[model samples]
Target: MKGMASYSSSHGRLAMAGNLALFCLILELASVGLAHADELRVGYYSSSCPSVEDVVRNTVTNAVARDPGMPAALIRLHFHDCFVRGCDASVLLDSTPGNPAEKDSPTNNPSLNGFDVIDEAKSTLESQCPQVVSCADIVAFAARESVRIAGGFYYPVPAGRRDGLVSKESEVNQNLPMAFFNVKQLEDNFARKGFSLEDMVTLSGAHTIGDSHCSAFSNRLYNFKNTTNASDPSMDQTYVSDLKSKCPAPGSGQDPTVSLDPVTPRTLDNQYYVNVKSHRGLLSSDQALMNRADTARMVLANINSGSMWLHKFADAMVRMGKIEVLTGTQGQIRKSCRIIN
Candidate 1:
């Protein structure tokens, strides 16, 4: 309890609520019609790898301590992995000869940076519980732990996911939503994965903590559909000016990074809703939430309610983690997260 107090003080207004509130928020998520498959269970590692959670927690904690941005990267890693091959950790594999992996994809290469941390956890797990914990489950658990480390609500991450044997660069674009996608595109993408449109909006809130490259959004700033205005009319003019100063028109030979949430960008919370509502979302895909009345309403709800969005976010994550997961004997538990074993 005292340690949590120390963390709360150090993090400073992340989630902007106490641990008790976060706990209650997660409790409320269960009754909110959120659902996932029965294949994975919270205690999946209770007998096979009892220390799985602790090992991962320690690995992620140490990594974040060294690099505060690691939490966001870990969460992003989870998202990328799940979107492609159902949280099977196919995204973590290195590209082989004539077989480029997901990590090498232009959308992922030079952007994703939490593989070492996952490897560290996998290595420790292999020593203590070899061939027991799967890399897929490790990625899922790391994201859950990252949310807590970044001062968001703690959610239960069901385990039992098996590491996938396949990873392809070609699969990245089809599976992951693009930065230039419209609301309809995003809706269909998450919908095909069995997520409601509201869940799509909720999951987009993960953008609240991470940083994005200028390349991802320069089109919105410089050339939005070849319109007479030369920029997205929906975006706030002041924010556009600020972004232009940092991004420098895209062809200046530099790809500087900007925080996804200018307000408490390092912290995981509902401020992403605040940013989108204010028309300051970094990506067109993110700001597109306001394009539809239905999606906009969910954003407002997330901002107005006290940690209700965070609660719903946990629920969304649970469902997202189960996206076509391979369990039981479906896949092998890779000895190394970077290669099939």
Candidate 2:
């Protein structure tokens, strides 16, 4: 096969056949053909759902244009989905009478939006292709399109994931990382998900675009580590004051939100690393990346090289999309994304 990707910059260019193969092999992506039958492939829907890419692109483009935050929501929605049930769209499932779903978990609740986007895309695919495209694949592809719109980093999403049948609120916390995790905790969390220290740091750079409720980080502002009225010393004092103005102390009133990336909250870029380096990162987890030598090295690399980080981020996303995914006959293609069909 011909080279599948290339990148060029004032720094240099990499378009050779050997480079592409090495990168793909490293990423464990695009294992084409039935030989890797259950594995995902870049063009799995070439004949089955020929319009898959365009349909998702149109749907997400309109949504993001309407709401600038939609890109973050979609990107996070994909991450949350993959973390829990391996990109099976379990996060899209609605809560039944007795069983709550992952979406309602405190880690996710009220913040994880973009279900409508997935439903809308699935609705279109069902009408046109019908039962062929899985909700899991839709979530995965929608996430890739979302990244393209927000960061201009285009990555191929290998499809063929099947929707999962189970989504438990109980299972969420064990699988997902928390906001207050230190470097060791963060490394261990991603390691459990088959990600390296570099992968964890690269993926965390997605925080460049999102918003976080004050409730998520109030610990750092007031009563940090049982010290009343003391903010986290690692957090820049000016940024802390700015955050306090927006998010009143706990019990003050409604929980307002602040952008994850104060500099460019609408665009996915290396500004996240920039914030961490300045001690202005929003979440403790964001700020924590700079606490250690190895992770901090990764952060510095992202800070100095935006284009190269984009390439790494896309590669990480592709690897993430393959996590414990259900394909072939392992799971069903849900007729409606919200319910098991």
Candidate 3:
């Protein structure tokens, strides 16, 4: 009798432990499912808004054709939107009576554009499927199409992202990477958004297409830090001379603008990496990629290979599009992208 009782007690203990372990495993799996519950998937709109992508693609194609610079502008708009509030289309919101929005931020105000393209796409989408799609998704779709139009290949963008209601100007400064950031700072900024060093190097390749205002990098072309009159010593001398011709000294005139990738300013390609390797990077933050060995290796890899950077850039953009997305009824889909619904 005593032996039988002891065996029963031991079996009971083992059973409880097994049950506890199994419960923990279940909890872990559940948490993971909840975490990715809103995972964006390609063809998300196939059933609901089958013609949505077509509308957005045509809109972006027309816009980019009108102004070749529009592709970069659209990409920048998406980047700005994602970084601050996780690709929520908050950047598109205009200031309200009681609340200021992200679009009003100094960092975004002058730099970000291409709102018209998004609005046009949204109007078309609404005509086809009213309130079924989101402005956030529209922004993402436009961005992907813009990349395709700009010489970068088209990669599928997972949709289902909803628009965010809040858009604080103050949040932009803390979130967006600055043009003057060093390699470490750039890495940290991307890291906060769940990006790797390689991802950082890859997305920076977007600079391959587009022009930046002279004010963004005037310091790199003129008396850098008031310590030298010849501009940033790290820059290639010839490139510096060329930039000086385009930008001139600050007070001489209104802030001018220069192409980010002089070799192929209007083309989206791996040439940006080549420029980075040659120290022709327009932004100090761009040149800073070479300050670290790991990123420098990525820069070299991108420069050495053709089409490789484009593939990497597309992958990085997809990853970036997933940052802090609002889905599963988390946020409302705004009727007009500029105002919360």
- For model 1, residues 1-341, the per-residue Cα lDDT tens digits are 99999997878765556776888886675433133346689899898789999999999999999999998999899989989977799998999999999999999999998999999999999999988999989998999999898865798888888888999999999999999899999999998777899899998999999899998988888878875438888899999998888987756899989999999988988899999999998898989998899999989998997388878888888888887788777879899999987
Model 1 bad stretches (over 4 Å): 1-36, 227-229
| Tens digit of per-residue lDDT, candidate 3, span 1-341 | 99999999999999999999999998895565446535778999899889999999999989987898999999899899999978889999999877878898888777789999999988888877989889989988888988888875889899888888899998999999999999889989999887888999899999988988888998887778886675888899998888888786878777767899999998889999889989899998899999889999999998888588888888888878888888877788887888887
**In model 2, which regions exceed 4 Å deviation?**
1-38
Error of 2 at 231 (Å): 0.7
| TM-scores, all models, native as reference | 0.87, 0.89, 0.88
Q: What local distance difference test score does each model get?
A: 0.88, 0.89, 0.87
- TM-score of candidate 3 against the unseen true structure: 0.88
User: What does candidate 2's lDDT look like per residue over 278-305, in tens digits?
Assistant: 9999999999998899999999999999
Count of steric clashes across candidates, in order: 1, 0, 1
Query: Candidate 2's C-alpha lDDT?
Result: 0.89
Cα deviation in Å at residue 35, candidate 2?
A: 8.9
